[model samples]
Target chain A: MSAPKALRQPASLRLVSAAFLAFWCLIAAFPIFWIAVMSIKVPIDAFAANPLDVILGPLTKAQGDGLSLLGIVAWIGFLWLTFRVCTRLLPALVSRHAPFGSAALGWLIAALAAGVLFVLLGFGVLVPLVRALDGALGLEPLIGLTTQHYQAVWVENAFWRNFVNSMIVTGGVVTVSLTVGTLAGYGLARSGSNLAFWILIVALVFRALPHSVLVAGYLPVFINSAEILRPILGDAAPTLYGQPLAVIAVLVAINQPFTIWMLRSFFQNIPADLDEAARVDGCTHFQAFRWVIMPVMWPGVITTGLFSFLLAYNDFLVTSLLLDASNQTMVPAIASYFNRETTTTDQVEAVAAAVSITAPLFLLVMVFQRQIVSGLTAGAVKG
Target chain B: MKFKTFAAFVAPSMFMMFLFIAAPLVSVFLQSFYLTQPVRVATEIETCTPGFTGQVCKTETKFLPQLDENGKVITETTFVGLESYRNVVQPDHAWAAISSFDWRGLMNIDFWKALRFTLTFTLLTLPLVIGVGLALALAVNNAARSIRGPVIFISLLPFIITPVIGALSIRWLFVGDGILTRLMEAYSGQDIAMFAQAWTIELLMLFYRVWHVAPFAFVIFYAGLQTVNTDSLEAAVIDGATRFERLRYVIVPHLMPLIVFVALIHLMDAYRVFEEVVGFRSQAHVISLQWLTYDFLEPDDAGNRSISRASASAMLTMIGIVILLVPLLRKTWRDHKGAH
Candidate 1:
């Protein structure tokens, strides 16, 4: 780790670099931190004229919605436990089971189990226990805190429906794109033909297309889909315009090019010897891919799947344009919350919804930070 | 692999791409030239109302769209042949404004206005993202090893957050009596509204984009740093190279291809900036090419949409991306050829 004589930085340069990095870390993370604070307070406190007032939340405390000292300790403990479970326990459990002997499936089961356990403990156990402790101790409110906005957003406004829709679209996209992309990528990686190169290039171009343009292309056809399908389905044909299925199809198409390109690079990294060894046993190509290459390909497949999940989950244009109001995904749903006229309470709820949308992404990054970073750098490095 | 096997393996993905991406592109290209409008017939209708104690009757002509047997509006499509493009660009007005050197006049046009913002936003953020990202990478490289993991984790949060949500969070921080604005107003002792004017909103958009994208650059450059040849650094030091000189010559040259890679990706993503416009609600003062197309395609209450114009705008946007990408793509092509 020793630096070369000329490569060594001066003390002042090191100091400045440290300061700059700290500043950047602040700039990068402050907004999320700030908004999470804003989401839990009364409107007056959230939008206070003085920044300290927003943080201290005096008005919110006066409104009888403050957190007691005990409550704060309990909540902090709960959060720390959750973090420990996600980063420590979950990984250990996942590795122990290796459920189905597949890394992807093991992680999936662990993540689901963690989520369900989190809900049950946080709502079913912690809240009631905290209230009981407060009553027993006769403690007064200390600092302001409220879950009313979150309650309004998730329950009254039924943001859970949007959450469900987002899951369906994202799940469909990840499953289909990965299933299709892995095969094509493996095929292209194995083939050294000019046609394979050309197909890869075309896919790169397709990857750069703005989603809006694609949405524009799909709109008219979607609007006329019933008529187009009538000849085959005999009068029961359904319009695809407003269905989540339509969005899943379009997102899969939009995601495929990148998926193929990434997975192709990953497949290329594996030596040709292993697959050749498998083929020497007189196995079919698909059989070799399934039985030999795939077990080794799990890491790459998981990385690529994380990206496809992000793209489909975070999408606004395709989901917003293709799906109608009732079927709206979370991103577009949050946008619609802003599109309407807003009362202050409604605006706070919007902030709550915005904060809620970020929770799953935060968890994903926490668990898969290494894979995500590698996924990003993988494409650039090879290029 | 055999040809049949390759084809079989790639068939599903190729079919999806053909049906969705390639076909839609063709459809968009053709759609830009054709305009579809509901067929409206002018009919005289008698309206009777009680007015001032007596029934008053008046005959008025109204245009109503004709519907067919299935309760669907009858429509006709006609080839307009560049009319939609002309409508979008407004060449006559653009030319007049350009000839007179009237930048304001040009900015008043929706297409020109959007193009101006989109280009400025894209081009301006490119260097900033690279610079900031490189600096962050260098900083982390120079820091104590124990802290890099936490620093990298915190830095990645911004990039992974949903783009609209990211923009919305920033907006809430500064929109109306938000914390940042309140602090600014307090320090400056002047009333300040970030969203009330074009310049501030534009600045925020630029800042937000750089903030959102710099981590991507950092991760790539950091990975690049791992592969930097220490032998070259030792040779440079023996040759009496200064710290900056080593970075300027040995380090940057090694990272040139990566710089181009980041720039290319940034150009493609930034050209279609739409989330900021929605999240900031800056349509009154700021709009982007993607937003303009969306506005055109959104159906009005009368069930009317300017599909041709939307298609033309979308096509123009795609062309812009291609044009911006040409230099980078050519470099990539050269590298590919050289490698082979």
Candidate 2:
């Protein structure tokens, strides 16, 4: 509203808003934080003990099984050194920007104070209590941290195969969808025809269809095609039943409608004069698209490509139904980890696998947060 | 552009759309009317044994695959008409339940149980998602500049997580000896098993849906907020309008289109809920139409799949989507005509 007077809301309202935002922020981030922590913890610590206790508890004698007293001392000394460096160096860096940066200095001091509290809690209270309890009750180590679960999932579980399958499928989908969708979207945007309009409408309708519905239709066709081809192809014919190509084809088809719509809007934003200008320069429509429009449309193409990759990468229904056991992608592979046959230890490994799959996506989102946010809003707001 | 050039450009997408999308739809419709299985026939096998008096002969009836003269196993596909659909809807059973005044009997039917939950899940979460999302948009819009970026990123994390992972995360929190379960038990001084009951699981699923989808609505609403007419807002403020009055009068009307857009998308997505049922392992308690189709496709003890029933269920799901989409389609058609 640009009302300067309205900006000066009461302090109470501002405080309430801040508190509310903080509460929701915790709710949004805590599960991920919890999973990250659980992923690194030893299996016993992960499943046997409460998560809060594991985070807050000190190292018991059993937890210190592989460690020497000297190691503990070194850890304490390292923490102290880190605390001193942050307290001394951070304030100096802050004061250069503002002459009176007392708030910055206060924040630095508060952070250091929290570090001191954690050290005291870890060593003085938690360690002694755990050691005493262990000595009295002969209790085993209840909490310990290790990266072994990640290693096990990577090596013993052959997760690399699933990761590669996901990459191949996603790569195939992104390339195929972008290429075909761009052509179609450009056509629909530049050519004002009844046929193009009808095609766009049909694409919209198809886009609304659920993935399971499509999968249901594909099952019979794939099975029948495999049988029909068996006499000619011999032993290789059955590959169609669980082949990655079949899954990729379906993924591209399902994703094409959305991709086309997104690209159409993007293409529409580029003025038609550009195409006319190129035509006047003796270039055909395809030539104009390849040489002139594409460069200008690169950002939109990339955004659409990212969305396509997400569709293929994140899909479960098609991949699970189409791909056999050995060919399962990461989502379905991780799903297979959850069953009645698995024990608590396996559950820990499953959680670790979940973390493994999510970490890369988290990093990707962090890197492309702006693009993803814009792409998501582009459809709804424009419509 | 000429029609030839346009066709050349769009041919690939058109071919794919026809092959995979349009054809599959037609195939699904046709498949709903046909049932395929191995052909079986009764055959007689004779056994003779030498006895003290004479040779005793016995004939036994056995079921065998029907074979032609070429010795190839015969498979039969027959026109089922509306039989598969009848099996799914169970109209006779539904009538019995209704006439006998047995509401529980209706719930016992898989189709109705799944339908009741699916509708409840979709319709109930609509208002909650929109309300929470709009509230979040308003809050984040007012948040300090330095903090807004991080807040938005954190809020979007829930939505960004894969649907299965998101559902599982919530399930883990409430499952036996999980953190939230432990906390609740500790706080109330009583043992509570969240997954042991139907209502709790349904409640958690509803909560999860809101948590996972509100970010989408928030993003749309936030974008809409940026386009609000400043002149009108200023005029309202000058007329001594309070914050709530200004919001209701100016901002709400401005965001109405975006609200409808989000609602349409959400309805389409929520209608075919599947991942949550699988992720929560709630098949024992709750199911959806999509899951019902998948269930029908699962092989039984004899390794025979109910493809006919699955096709019927898939068709039913599409019908539901088409019904929900009719209003939106009508509006779109009207807009198209007006623009022309």
The candidate scoring highest on DockQ is 1
| Candidate closest to the true structure, highest TM-score | 1
Clashing pairs in 2: none
Model 2 per-residue lDDT tens digits across residues B69-131: 989778799998999999999999999998999988998889998999989999999999999
Off by over 4 Å in 1: A1-7, A99-101, B49-57, B334-340
Cα displacement (angstroms), candidate 2, residue B170, comes to 1.2
- Per-residue alpha-carbon lDDT of model 2 for A1-383, expressed as tens digits? 34477545778877888888888888888877787766666555554336665453333224554223434454567556644544354444544543342332343344445455655865577566656655776655543455567778889989889988988888888888888999999999898887887788788789888777777788877877867788999867765668888887888899888998898888988999999999999999899998889877866786787788777887878888888788789998987788742676677788888887776566445544666788888787776
Off by over 4 Å in 2: A1-3, A56-143, A229-239, B44-60, B66-73
Assess each prediction's global lDDT (C-alpha) against the native: 0.90, 0.80
What C-alpha lDDT, on a 0 to 100 scale, does residue A242 get in candidate 2?
A: 82
Instruction: Encode model 1's per-residue lDDT on B46-138: one tens digit a residue.
Output: 999999989999999999989999998899999999999999999999999999999999999999999999999999999999999999998
TM-score of chain A of 2: 0.76
What local lDDT score does residue B299 receive in model 2, on the 0 to 100 scale? 65
Query: Which candidate should be chosen as best, given lDDT against the real structure?
Result: 1
